[model samples]
Target chain A: MVFSKEVKSVRTQTWIGIMSVASLVAIAGIFLKVAMSTQPREENYENITKPGYAIRRKYFWALLIVSVVCLVISVISFPYPAIMEAKITGEPVVVKATGFQFGWELDKDVLPVGKPVRFDVTAKDVNHGFGIYYHGKDGSLKKGIFVAQTQAMPDYINKLYVTFKDPGVYRIWCLEYCGAAHHIMTYEFRVE
Target chain B: MDVADRSMYERRVSGIALGYGAITLVLFGVTVFFGVIMRTSQGEFISVRPDVLYEFMTLHSIGAGGSLMAGVMAVMWYTLRKHLDMSMNIMQVVFGIIGAAVVTIVAVTLLGYYGTGWTFLYPLPFKSAGAWYDFAPGMWLLALMCVIFAFAMSWIDVIRAASKKYGFSNAMGWTLISGTAKPENVPPPVVLISTVTAACGLLSLVAGFIVVSLMLIHWANPSYYLDYLFIKNLIYYFGHIVMNMIMYMCAAIVYELMPIYANRPWKSNKIVAISWNSAFVAVTLAYWHHLLQDFPQPLIFQFLGVFGSYMAAFPATVVTITGTLILIYKSGMKWKVAPLYMYLGLMGWAIGGFWAVMDAGFNQAVHNTMYVPSHFHTYLLVGAAFIFVGGLYHITEELGGCRDTFEDKLGLWTWFVGGYGFVLWFMISGVLGTPRRYAVQMPGTEIYSTAAVYFAWTVVFGLLIAIARYLTRLQSVKPLRG
Candidate 1:
């Protein structure tokens, strides 16, 4: 409910931005104060005031309450991760994708569009990141944009949730570093 | 022990601290050089073989993280031992294990060609697919296990020594929180180090045990299975905790030492104690934040991660930064080279913590592609590294009975300017959304990456200056006798 503003999603960036500004301000203030403060040969500020125990106690409680509030707000509105939240309603086309150190092997090279394709990603030789990307006009992985992906670890199957709505060629590139050829680990599949 | 014997023993330990800290500094230098090489390669300013780049990648990652750990531990232990009695035998054991671990790790990466990257991620280590030798992964894992065990042992010793001095309850500053004892009764160093040692010890056990056990099983049977998500959490947490602990450990040094320069007593107060206690929880739960983008991670944990990540920032200011600020407030600060680093180190910690909190969000995870590495580098390089280097400057100056020299200023400014410049480029690239860990980057990323390389050279110059100063200072000390 707290993130129920115009964006519909929690604007975490705004909060971070505010915090960043505050941080810069605090740092600058401290640095200036330190730079400007009188430098003496010996310590001179005798019997600097210390707060009463009561004020300290109040601060302790205030911090505790603030922490509790933050925790509560986050807890109450916590949504399932994206994949979990948008579980496919109908049966999906199953695809078995195997990741090797340098390449990928899918059940089929071309995937049929319109049906949700559920990829059971597994690594044959080593762990590789199975990031599905679509290349831009430059035709370089450098220009490749991410679509959907999951880590392909050996001896483990990661069921990646995806449903391609449009016809296009996509590439499965290893995201996690496996070895020398990790960057070269890629497989292209056509969605028609 | 007689005063003469005690002083001799203290001198011996001081020599060991200087020796170990120097080794770590060397290791840091090597890794930073390789890091520049990789950045330049990725930026396409120069061309290198793919395998070679990756080999350097793997080495640089682990080398930086691991060496920093060993380096800071020695600095902290040296300071700690001066205050209370510690087992010299235990120190020797730690030194031996670290020596063995670093040798094995460097050998496997450079000589044996283990290039799976430091996370070793999981299944990747088991299935190198002929890129690396079969046994190399196992050896790397064993090396990591050795380092983990050694560090854990060191922490255990610190905890035991501290608890004994303060009675275990007061050691953690819990009595301050409970209001059973006055805050002044317990030293702030004990509270900070005790909390970090205990938390890191327990969490490291969880991570180390799970990972090494799973890894051993794979080595033994090759048919045995482990869950992907489980292994991911374990390895990530292990790495995260270690990185997080570096901040805590070095901050411990700052809290204890900085006030000495500023002429203020950093007493363990309600806010300070509470902030740190909160940090203990925050650092642990913050691990889940790293896994937020993973589809399989639980929803509540993701929320907890958000909360935890934010919680960590509290101590950064309320305890460490503000505490320093208040300590230095209008008090005549000496502004020595060592204390200057400490002050900047606090600035680094605050700035880096802010960047980290920004990147921790699930929505912002996309933006974190490059920002993650930048945030961490900012914290580690400028933040924790500064505090620690400052501490070293303090220790060397104090023990060597030397005065601050013009040479010290040269070392100080160069390191500061060059280090900050390099990190600035990284953050700039992050803001521009240049993805990290990519062997190669897009055209748009080249400028920032190229700039980083130039600044890196500046850092090297600074390091050379620092090394020269330290060497001159250390030259006065007599060699330790057997």
Candidate 2:
């Protein structure tokens, strides 16, 4: 299946970049403004004698609140795990995954497209990351990053809920460096 | 003889601080080689196994972070001691503990192949999936526990000293909270370090508990388990605090040294006091932002974490930055490398900090992306690293009677250029969706590593010149006893 790769929000990214660059330019501008300034040094501007500090303090606090509010809003909008709040319209394909020394084992392989899949992951021997990757339009076998993941604990199961709208060959890789052949830890699946 | 009235306590503390700084510098030098090697391997210029690369990752992160903290802490202990009566006994003991911890850390990474990254999150340390000896994680945990104990002890000493001079509330800049005392009376550094000490002290205790808990589980019931979320939070809380404290304490160095370099007094004011106090309040919840991707962690925490982080982080950087810019505005001080590094450090801190805030902000979804490693590396290397180095150089030149001249401007420029270049690699790579801590590199990822490898070598060369100068000059001169 072909789709534009991970329609990463250009607007969001651009906004973040603008904020980052704007802050830099502002700080740098102020730094340059101050560093290059040949203004005569004022005397007795130590704490009590400093003027406009009240105004500075007021502005500082106001900016602090504004930035924090902005940050919280950004966090809310950013992509978060829909697992907890997800209302399943239909039953999610439940795949039981067990991880061990060198590999991953899944109970089933085929997953339907436009469906939610719940990966119930656990470890038989140790800790592992149940990281699932989708086949990009470029069709690369994902080794490093993954689409959805959760901890595969030895005694407890970690449930990860993910919905794939596009059908593609996907792979699961252990993200946590487990052992010597950890690089070889991979499992492939299908979305039909 | 020096004209200053010398106290034995002062001399002893200074000696230990120098000792710590020396060890830190040496550790950083070794770790940089590992970093360079890892980058080269990632660039596909060399062939190495995934395990080896992972091992180096663990070694390099802990080694460099530990080294920088030690260097800056030495400066903190040295400078703070002069102003406030810090504990000599605590300093001495920690100095010894740090030595032991360093040896053990090196052994665990080199000899035992403890490849669980510095975070050592959850059960990864307990169960290495057949890569390392069972003892490797145990040894690493114990060493880390020891390091935590030493750090906690030192922090306790700071708390005690601050509390002794100023009451706990005032030491924490409670006047800012209550609007009782004037900001000028609340000394910024004391308030700053005390706040940091409290946060780190709590984190260390939590770390100690988890380490001991994990050890007990290891020995008694090998099959025993933990709430992965709980352990993950604890470990990151410890790691985050450790990383930030390296900056917080180093900021003390900047707070003390920057003024001296500029020949001005950076007095405590309403802004400084309020900012530092706010940090004390907000820092407690900030580490949770690190776990926004962990799914199992609640959304409420993610929100709280992001808010707490920005609140804690923004104020101090803003106040210090504005303060520094204003200090240098009209002060006609010569821009020596020491002071230049200070300016550069502050600039890096501000820029890097912006990246960090963005990474924390959920709207970006940059956490766990390439953005994480790049932003952190920016802060750690360009921001915290420069602050600690500049502060150390300042302390040494003034008090330790060391003069460094005819140094490699070539090396310095190369370092600055390469450092920024390497930082850009991380930022760009992160933006382009290159994952961090990947043992084996994907094809496109090699491009970032290739650029980083060349840039890293320049950084190493610059450091080599700087370190050579420091060691030669410092070796002949004992901190203050001479």
lDDT, candidate 2, at A68: 66
Task: Compare the candidates by lDDT and give the number of the best one.
Answer: 1
Clashing pairs in 1: A127-B124, A129-A175
Per-residue lDDT over B1-482 for candidate 1, one digit per residue giving the tens place of the 0 to 100 score: 89788778867787678878777877877887788789778767898777778888888888988888788888888777756666777877887898899899889887877887777777767666666777787788888888878887788888778777666667677777788865445756644564555566567666876788788778778889777778888887887878888888888788778778777676776566777777888888898886664545666677878888878877765666666665675677777888887778778887888778667643332333555676787788777777777877888777776677887888778877787777767665554334467676644457777778777777778877776776677765544332
Per-prediction TM-score to the true structure, in the order listed = 0.85, 0.88
CAPRI category for model 2: acceptable
* Reference-based lDDT, residue B307, model 2: 83
Off by over 4 Å in 1: A1-100, A104-125, A130-173, A186-192, B1-4, B182-185, B190-192, B442-444, B478-482
Per-candidate TM-score, chain A: 0.58, 0.67
Of candidate 2 chain B, the 10-residue stretch with the lowest lDDT total is: B362-371
lDDT of 1 by residue, A1-192 (tens): 011132212244345445545765676676776666635433444433254234334644675686677556555433333543365577777899998857888998777766777888877766566776554322444444545556676676677666665456667766666776666667888877
- How big a share of the true inter-chain contacts is recovered in candidate 2? 0.37
Q: Which stretches of candidate 2 lie over 4 Å from their true place?
A: A1-6, A9-33, A38-69, A72-75, A78-101, A115-127, A130-132, A137-165, B1-13, B182-185, B188-192, B195-203, B216-221, B400-411, B475-481
